[model samples]
Target: MTTPPRPWPGLFISFEGIDGSGKSTQARQLYESLRSGGHDPLLTREPGGSPGAEEIRALVLQGDPDRWSAETELLLFTAARRDHMERAILPALQAGRTVICDRFADSTRMYQGRGGLRDKVDALHDLMIGIDPDLTLLIDMPAEAGLARAKSRATDEERFEDFGLDLQQRMRDGFLALAAAAPARFRVIDGNRDMDSVARDVHATVLRELAPSS
Candidate 1:
């Protein structure tokens, strides 16, 4: 008798942070650790995965400073995400590769929703109705600290990152709110801690999630 085809098994995890939170660093650390531990992992980022998404990312990030609006930015991000999911993320997962995304839908909800366009948050939600991360890590940090760190590293700030302090603060609050609403899926990490400590906690969190329930 012929045997049935084997199915690919995978997991999806996303990292989120306002700025200077070191989420991208930690996400890379986790991705390395997963691979070192013998897991098939795919490390990718939003707004720039597939070719289509890359084009959108260029427009979103490198646009004229005064040429963009909040709603336009949000729509661009969501469009990139939709293309990324269908072309990169979903395919990798189905092929049995654990997918790690640096930023995802939550970033839009936090940045656009709480930053200034609170009215557009629901519309953004509608854009990401079916996409959900199996795990989301929120690297929480103060707005001032994050801004400082972000500025230190970036030679020229992107439009969103260049927003006012109040906007960044509200974005941080948005992340916290989402974490509170979904304790099981969202892990809030204090970004003020040492890098080693943050990485250690991320490792522990991933292991715990991979472990079988009691």
Candidate 2:
């Protein structure tokens, strides 16, 4: 059992995109930039932020595609998120620190919900993890290009990427649709350019979002 988190006065920023979309890179850059500019920012990732959640991340990420059923994976992801919220995210946010997460519930919604379990995913999130990011930065690009970048990566966490180009394309489309539905909280950035340009757009967008609170 864990102690409940206090209300977060700070901002909660999440980055979402398909594999190889460069969200991770942009997220890190934002964290570093904020830190250098004298801001209190906490950088974290989904499925693996807190200690317990990190352990679960290995289980879900490094296994065969069919190792866990969609339902089971949903449960596992929710549990990990619950733990991460309790241990890592809420604490920093309570301290008025910006929490920049690499991924969040949106990822779960898109990845696990790609199948027929979208309703279940939302229900579980509402029940077990009832919070959403204040802002979500979506790195958008062509599916084939993103898939190629993802395939070039030499990591064991290729379970999702192994699903092939069709799934990647679908995921990209789903992400775009999600952004469209929530224009206020979602900022879509073109990711086909050089890393520096993408990072610049991400930084400027985040600055604009944070201006009100800053």
Candidate 3:
């Protein structure tokens, strides 16, 4: 299960899902919604939030899928996250700014915590970067539909997506399991519907989280 974030005044929100689950779009939508509501929210993404992290992003995301071993990839990702937290996320939260991140440690838990490396992943996370978003919105949809959507406009970062449908299915199941384990921290949103409908749910869920004192 995920733990609460450090006691910061800012609300930390993260969007999670399998590739092409529309999580990135929803994250952006929520950021826009918060801005429109007169809240100062910082929009960011994992594996590349700070300049140092962005450098590692290309190294892991591009090139052949077999370019780096899963263990190496894990270290690279964790390093990027550490830099991102130090340079961007932590400071924003410290300033009492809502940090809206497209992805976070959960992505590492999914993407790299495979092939029996979950224990290592968790251990490293606890040792190096020990924080999770207060709330994570998981955009859920069928794996087939999501893979199809992901491949439509695939780019060089397509290394992960290129794993094809089987991996996508496993990732979807893994994500759902993660959500089930941490119900209080996760809001599972259906992403198979139209974009507007999905955005409405995302917006409403976030509003409830912010209602306590925003």
Maximum-TM-score candidate:
3
Q: List candidate 2 stretches off by more than 4 Å.
A: 1-7
lDDT (10s digit) by residue, model 3, range 82-194 = 99999999899999999999989998899899889999999999999998899999999999999898899748788988899989998899999999999989999999999
- Total residue pair clashes for candidate 2: 0
lDDT of each: 0.80, 0.91, 0.91
The local lDDT score (0 to 100) that residue 91 gets in candidate 3 is 93
**Arranged by lDDT, best first:** 3, 2, 1
Residue 165 miss distance in model 3 (angstroms): 0.6
Error of 2 at 67 (Å): 0.8
1 versus 3: better TM-score goes to: 3
TM-scores, each model vs. reference: 0.87, 0.94, 0.96
After superposing candidate 1, which stretches have Cα over 4 Å from the reference? 1-8, 115-129, 155-157
RMSD of 1: 4.9
